[model samples]
Target: MKSTVLTRRGALKCSLAWAGAAVWTHRAPRALGFTNANARPRVAAIGTGSRWCQRATGIDGPHGSAPSFVPFGDYVAVCDVDADRLGLAVDVVQEWTGKAPDAYGDYRRVIDRNDVDVVQISTPDHWHAKIAIEAMLAGKDVYCEKPMTLTIDEGRLMCEVCRKTGRVVQIGTQQRSDESFLTALAIIRDGRIGTIKKATCAIGGGPTSPVIPQVAAPKNLDWNQWLGPAPDAGYRYLAGDNGETQSWSRCHYEFRWWYEYSGGKLTDWGAHHVDIATWAMEKGATGPTLIEPLAVKHPVPFSAGFPTDDTQYNTATEFLIKATFADGMELEIRHDGDNGILFEGTEGRLFVNRGKVAGAAVDDLANRPLPDGALRAVYKGKEPTDHFRNFFDAVVDRSEPISDVHSHHRALTTCHLAGIAARLGRTIRWSPTAEKIVDDPQAQSFVSRAPRNGFETEV
Candidate 1:
């Protein structure tokens, strides 16, 4: 395949937060790789499903969603397991870029393209690590969605591959790019909030599914490929209690509810909130010493760390976990309270979420503004643009992305531990340095699962 160096004009999207913030470049674009200064990276989008639409369409929110996939890279190819979605994504990408991209069902096809410079993996969580590792091995950088792995071990492997490949891979925890979060971190770093003692993340709860009854797989959907490394299971669905208004299914969006495919809300929202809290605390490659499932409620029965029934959503619907860090700081993961992180320090406190940042620290920022370039310092010395734009810049600069895998792995370990504790109805002691579950071999076993033959995610 010809190495397509697609023209990506306007990749440097100047955010009002920092419109002229230090010029947003660490190095000039390589002359040979790009046709001109405005040349864009070519992208191969794998798993062109729900998230692709959510990001490409740009839904309205605290930050305007109108900017899309082009801000990160131009699509040279798109891949998905479901033929219907694959077709739709091709049309969407063609419409967005005014040129049609090649399409494929198997992601390997996308990864194998020499023309592709980046592989954007927005697949279900279970598929993240495998696809990312494979893409990296193939010399492609990665932009994977949050909750980057279905299991904790995959995170460890991701970090290893990142180091081995020396690729500037970025996780899709876009909160790191938001001004609200950047401001919150800068305030903490500036010492407005004294020594942090506790961080509470009110990530909210996941919905419980009614028993989703098995149904025939749609002809357009490749159920086997969708199952992939997960255990083979029947497709299931159920309508809302009214049997008409809404619906639930075993695949696609609802895959997060099944342990076989992904962690529940623990990893879902935990990836975002815990990541921010960890960054503020400077936990830096270390995780909690202990993860205790203070309380939990699953929609179905679980035994020996596996759900007893495969017909219903098994992830915890409501739960609270207490994690104790090496510095005596405590982090709480809970299902109740507003969806955000609350940082409590010895002298002050603050709350931050997608919508806003609140508390004494924010007010203090008025009387004492953060040191100049403080927000950039919070974001690894780069002007924090919108998430996708930051990634686009990193591809050129080859600097560590704000949401690099190492820190995300550290934060996600807490979430994965909390999830294991919830499934087992117990507490787990962990060795952050050793990266081990510590005492119980059975619990340690949950760290990684053996994928089906030929599906193993090993490097």
Candidate 2:
């Protein structure tokens, strides 16, 4: 099989050619090397910051020690706006692969490389959609970090781009790969909880108040590039001025707190919890019809940190947002709860978090013998064997991976709406079908932000 070079024009042509085939049959493109065992998928990693580094750590090292990363794919390149982190990632890849993968400051260069087949993007919230869209348009399969887009429009656009390009995309909402979440969703779908009346999804507080004092960016870092697509804001080092210099901690992980850089906890952790909660409720492919921010009270004033009264952390720290679906079910998103989902139903209530799933009704349901043929119906089903493995499998099979763009967009829409309500401090009406707000112009404005001149997203 010949590996075709992915390009914007090429994507358009392929889309037109494959449209009928894609719809008539749910088959994915054949694997790049189904007939050849020696052929491995050529891959690369973009935004080798903290999270990306962590995910890469799981891949086999230079010796091919791990089962999955046993030289299954080559890490051909790495890109990052931060020079320091980029160099560090390149070193890791070189050390593991025994060859130096090309390095680039601009992601476009990496995407333009015809040799690369896959790109794992772990950039900031604002950069996710832009890079993912471009990568897909360029014909590279993408594994992008979650809360997949900065705005609802971007999420939808991403889905369209992938569909049009015939590219595989896996949103990095890892819980979708976790067993606990799978089991819970299976239980709920099986009707073990009777009927899900409502659910409470809670995430921890956002950054505390009182802005941290400004400090100079490290000499080794490219602060300007790190702020890609976002407006130029003053850079602040995580550690105190002249403090200990850490390699990966420079400009990446800490960026999650700033509104210009990220959606704070709303997109950070909320991406995980809200995604799972919505998936369990069978709302992963759709969104809420109504959303209103409940009354929230902040604590006494203090300086920057979690729960502080600082304006720097613009995301909500303490708040509740009620999302009502078209089906008349409600989901309460709050900053406080048992750190999991509470499914209140007609038969009994079920509480499930990462560590455990428990309910008075769960015991009765467990004790009763499952009816013939009923067990299979409740299993929300598993990915194609392995979670990450499924990504590679889908790449070869041309089938949609478990965590496709459409479902991710729905989950992200819910997360984005929660953030918008918190930012506007009011209830807002949403039209899921049209993907817009109704009547309230003030609320509508928060749907997307004006990107910095050169980095604006192209629809």
Candidate 3:
């Protein structure tokens, strides 16, 4: 691959070349008579978990995934380490497309298929970098879930591979395609909110768990495969009562509560709200300069930034992390307050979440509706589509979507830095330009983690 910036035109050219490859063969042809039918991208769903659906309502129902892409692409294959979930996704795709697609336990098998041109990853954060990099290297475009990388270095590697592959990639930061956030961004950028002063995202915190006893991995689940790049750990579980089950294991939904595989609420919800805060501040191109743990409370003790306990949930149960950007604009991520973003500027203040946007600035919009193209400008000259639709549009056009990896890394880096500071119980300075921690090697070490054998991520 050439070492040059992947211009939109270059991407379009590549997309065309890809389209010119062997004509696609859709068994059921659910959308064959529709637009772009001849060159409809072949999709491979890499994870079948329902969090991507549960993250928002109206996308897919509980326990199913990947239905939205049916209009734009064909599901050539589906993969998940949990066989039950894999079967669930298989049934969903089969019902939608009228054809049952092949299923696989290993993502590499899906990546190896020349027939799969687009990969949709809904896996845990630990597997995001490895699978996305492998997919891109295989000449496949990717639509990966967010907090796209488990570590800072993984984000770097993803961006490098994206540039090298010139394949259209979109992160699952759907807020970029949400009407509420878009409307708020338009109002802010239109100067109704004036020059921004500070932004705060009150993302909720993680759950503390009683010591979950080690248990044998479920028969249908491949625990080692699910752990992926994270270190080997025991499978811990506490069975549920009347279907409201809780798992303390280092797998499944519980993985988010463990620092080993995720950055807890910081990266989970912060990935969504912090990203909006960064976008609203117009600081998507860079990260924070100083990340301070104003207050932090974890369930267990920590030494050298690593959690001391693995039998129970290890993430902060309550925390307030302040990240100061280069221009002195501060963004605070907290476990309290309304679960939304508050933006305060010199002239006016505004607040936005998945639900609504409010402020004097937004109220003014009722009288003086944003200038004709304000929302479109915020959407990069396109109308905001459902996040998955946006990815499909980018795939067809061979251009970048609303939430590209570059800006996401900048946003998630703040979350990662805040996580590090909270773990170390100290403030950590950062150089966003160099993308490194400054004056503290111990804190800097959190930027990347060595992968377990066979799970290493590289360009």
Candidate 4:
């Protein structure tokens, strides 16, 4: 496949064009019945695992549940290494669209199809950049899941691929589209939080060790294919021989606990909370200047002969990683805190979690009337509503959605840096403008990994 190289100026021009045109106009292709229905965008769902299935239903399912019936295009295909989950997605599409769409085990097959205009990827963390870039190269737009890349280099490559292909890529960091976060960001931007001095993001840590009694792969799963670009490794189901549920320490959803497949709770939860932190600080396009993981005190005995230091579940079980931004603002991501973000400024501090937002004297700020047109503007004139709807709207209009790649990369960068620091067990300084580590050759190498043969990322 031929890839286009975009000059920096050209890239900036395209970005500016997108910024100007995407705000008001719906950019998705016309609906199936519109005058230009032939040009209507046809979308395919790649990585039809549990999460992707949920997102698909959220978009194309019953009205009031999904976005307003936008007369969107069909789900032309579904792709997954797991046949069972792929079949389930096909069934959902068939039931909703009254048509049996094609199915494939390889996402490349879906990308090869000229009929597929957009590819929505909800693959594992490692596969996010590879599949999304491939789809863009195949002349398809992409809506990829959060933590946009597993590493910093991957994020840069994704941005370059999108620019080169002129593809519309949206990252599934849904909190940016949420009203509560938007409102919070608006207040922070409006100086309600004063000159933000420090912030804290707390997500619980990973299990202490690899799961035991690694069982055989299930009959319905293609374990090799599921591993994909990742190094070939032994297969071990969390379920033990007696059918009793084993430790939730590793594999699949639990894969988040492992260093090979994910960044543990850091990226798992950091993707959301860190995203809010960066957005609130208005640093969505940039990354941290320094990252230091506070040495952790592991509860498990180090000499226990158990595979505690094993590659499986190597993520930090307990630690505080502090990231310093360019503007002297600091973000401390910890394994133990209030389990949300705490923003402190000269005036006071505010704590926000999924359920509520409160502060030292938050009622005063919450009660104070926001400037006229403030709340409505924060909502972007749309009701503080569904994240999936925002993506659909961006798809139809060709506009950059609230949680686009640029902002997603900023959050992902923080997550990746934190993981790197934890893995290296040291502090690292970064040159965000250069996108490189300063004075640390060892830390710089962790920015990317070697892909398995025949699975190299081309961007």
List, in order, the clash count of every candidate structure.
2, 11, 0, 7
All candidates in order of TM-score, best leading: 3, 1, 2, 4
Error of 3 at 156 (Å): 1.0
- Top candidate on TM-score is 3
lDDT of 1 by residue, 1-459 (tens): 111111110221212122122122211232123334246677888886556674332222223221255655677898888888788777777878799989998786776565677888888888899888767766677889888898888998888878766677889899999999999999888888899999999998988776778999889888888888877788887776521224688787788888888888999999999999999999967989999999999988777988888877888989999999977999999999999999999889999999999998788767878899999899898877878777767777677888999999999999999999999999999999999999899999999988865566533
Candidate 2 segments exceeding 4 Å error? 1-38, 54-71, 238-250, 297-311, 369-384
Error of 1 at 240 (Å): 4.3
Model 4 stretches with alpha carbons more than 4 Å out: 1-40, 54-73, 214-216, 240-250, 297-312, 360-362, 365-367, 375-385
Cα RMSD to the true fold for all candidates: 7.7, 5.8, 5.6, 6.0
* Poorly placed runs, candidate 1 (over 4 Å): 1-38, 55-67, 240-246
TM-score of each: 0.89, 0.84, 0.90, 0.83
| Clashes, model 1 | 2
Those runs of model 3 whose alpha carbons end farther than 4 Å from true positions after fitting are 1-37, 52-65, 241-246
Query: Taking the tens digit of each residue's C-alpha lDDT, what string does model 2 give over 1-459?
Result: 012223333543555335434422332232565335445667777777656664333323342112233245677788877677677777778877689889998777887676677788888788888888767765677888777888888887888877776888877766776666666666677777788889888777764534455578767667776777777877654344321223212245656656666776778877888777777788876789899878553433322312333334445568788999999888887887678778888777888777887877456656874455443333233332445676777777667777788987887788788777776667788998888988888777778777776665443
Error of 3 at 123 (Å): 0.8
- The prediction achieving the highest lDDT against the true structure is 3
Error of 4 at 11 (Å): 22
